[model samples]
Target: MHAITPYLLKSYKGRDTEKKESEHFDLSNIKGKDLLELLHKYMQSKSAHVYDFKEEKRVFKFSDIDFDIKRRTVSAFLVAGFYGVRSDIIDKSTGEIRFPKSESDAEVLRHYIQFTVPPGSTETIGLFHKSRGVGIKSLFDKLFKANFLLETQATLQITPYAHTGAVQEWAKGASVKSLKVKGFVPSSDITVNLARLGECNTEFTISPKIKKKGFKASFGPLSDFLTPEASSTQNEIITLLSNQGASVRTVAELNGARRTFEVGANSGGVVCDIPFAEGEDEVELKGGQPEFQSTQKWARSLTNDILKGVYGRRAFQI
Candidate 1:
């Protein structure tokens, strides 16, 4: 058998204190993949999921297996997913299937559990170590200053991104702050006409940045902005623009503050309705990402999609 990869392990305190410093353990003996595969095998057995595991003097326990990894002696959980996910995704025989077929199993495994490298109680990876977004302001403050903006200076040929319900299912495991895709319902003017601009599958890149505060009650996190696929950002942007006029670059800029507020009122972000706009009109400004979501789905990468140019939405770098 191939040697398994090592891991950086740590304990997860409760939710209220989640943001605090944590304690870590270096699992010097077991490889991460080996540990996870063992957990998967055990989870398959209803009774075996919860059990004790020991490494030298350190003791660990997976108490009621609904994603909870605890020290055999304490009640703490482990910091898993994302940073420690390679072990879960890659298997010697199965390749890179990150999630299980059963929704129930996948959810439990992804959420509360962790095949992870836990950080020490005193560790810090610097202050900005977090999912990028205008947090408190997104919910309470009316103003969301642009963190960084990427407007298309020229015509951006969009690529058709595809996803089955399964890939989306996996996203929930790794999804950061965004709500799932099912949370959204497409707006009437939010058309997906691949052939909007003469011929199919193309969009004009007009300047898409506004100076002032953009929205009123924006919902979902930055991750929610990426819908079923990438480019979901520009897709929604064009859909709104098509309602006003159908050009790529010229009218793309919402020059006056008056018109900017209107865009928010009239349209939705990559997926969800901008909810409502306090201002008059707006456009995608840069800086920290401001994501969009209608009902569900979360691929915040910068795609041609809309709203947040993040999650899995891919933006062309010019």
Candidate 2:
């Protein structure tokens, strides 16, 4: 087997909110490739972005959000709610990011959660950070001797950095254009979802695509994504990607640390990391030397949690 070890270091700076803030992250796990494979799977999932969008009478109410990258975030994310999908509908339809750098394609998707509250109003609070200069594939490629170190980060303007909600990306490096989210059943309920203590999504715009076994890499236009041309199907594509992005807050913990993590991956599942304290500079893998089986174990665990969030399952399996 390929004994691939990884290392990573990252820092994040926030834009928009007052009292500008920044966070740092660290991750140098032993499960390098295993984690990478898992992350790859996550990015490839259909439910990673938005779920579903149905046009009905009275119109159950729904949302269509669009994200434009100002720069990269410290980490990327997967947010799943009511109506949307995480699957790479773009790849499925276009086979791959024809022009990942295209102002239109460089944008991030927003999942619209359609719900209803019997009597009183149901609030669907949402949290989001926007920026350009986004990128994800770089970190992915570094996993082995390969960086294994997942340097996830983006320079963003947290819509309400003070709020507890945000959006998720496959970590597929690309720039964002603009973001706009609206609609929820009853057209009133508000929803809020944020990256947990370790729930961080970040990246920079670096067009990376697969060409057989290697990547056809290139530099994507940063400004284009920031101001993409409006399209009729843009909203629909964004919705599809958003529904699939799924994440959950098990034990709500307010995390103000900006750190990065190392990773592993393959055809197997991915690794959902354990939170590392702030300023863990040059930190190594926790749990000592891991058995090959253990890597899969962690990947499986992360996959289950991700799936459960997407499907809302009490229990599950790959």
Candidate 3:
């Protein structure tokens, strides 16, 4: 008759914080026991899944015999297989597989347990991971284009030029007190003129010596501007441009101004402005007029109203 032997298998060591909560179990240790019966007794003794068994050669095998801690769930692989078992088997003649006898050996089992458990439960594991990945990707894409813009002049020039006289004024010695855009919308062609505190040569170049003020301009789609994608692209372009030292403000400001201009124009506010050339004698200007003078005048007036803070105050006011 084969004698069944029962032995108390040590419990796995928990991590530092969990060490106090770990439990131990004991059973009868016997020799020449049937492997399956030994496993049943071990599993029943501790209410856990550790088991030891011997094969035809009397080689000992250690197994978890329960849920896979690594996979975060109970699975057949951890129950009936050799997951935590050693590769070497003991022979009755060789005495190869031996029971662990030291604290270090018990620690090995503890590590196996700690390494198997997942950080979080199976549910909601991938929640923020997806959003975080998208945000990082978008940020990098924007940053790459911004770096590309710094190296190319043509790319900078491709942006619609406002033709503000400040470019020329900055070339001259005159200090520009204020810069305003006239007849500009998200899609409108902007025209800017610089004025000095006093009369000067109209053909004179702006001197680099003058310290120019920072520029601030807002733009949005005209009433007739129909493309939504273009509007979004323009907003992104403007943001990138501002970061590159173009001195732009919030995109919200541009959208608000556009809405105000549209409503005001519909209510009979003029939408243009026209400027008479500087230093033009009355006789030289008496009969000369551009065919688009009226339209230009309307645009100038609307832009001036926007710059003077009238449009913004009215559009966004409570």
lDDT by candidate, in order shown: 0.23, 0.24, 0.23
Estimate the overall C-alpha local distance difference test score of candidate 2.
Answer: 0.24
Provide the lowest-lDDT 10-residue window in model 1. Answer: 140-149
Model 3 TM-score is 0.13
Candidate 2 regions with alpha-carbon error over 4 angstroms: 1-139, 142-272, 275-287, 314-316
Question: By the lDDT metric, which is better: model 2 or model 3?
Answer: 2
Query: Model 3, 48-99: lDDT tens per residue?
Result: 5434322211112223334333332221111112233345435657677755
Runs with alpha carbons beyond 4 Å of true place in candidate 1: 1-21, 26-34, 47-318
Per-candidate TM equals 0.16, 0.17, 0.13
Q: Highest lDDT: which candidate?
A: 2
- Stretches off by above 4 angstroms in model 3 are 1-203, 210-274, 278-287, 297-308, 314-318
Q: What global local distance difference test value does model 1 have?
A: 0.23
lDDT of 1 by residue, 1-318 (tens): 000011122222224456665432222112222223333344344243333222121112223333323321111122111121222435646576765443112112111122321222211110010122111111101110111012111111111122212123222322221111211223344344533533323333233234457642222222232232334653465345545442211111111111111122222232121211112122121232211221011111111122112224232211
- Rank all candidate structures by their TM-score, best first, as comma-separated numbers: 2, 1, 3
Clashes of 1: 65
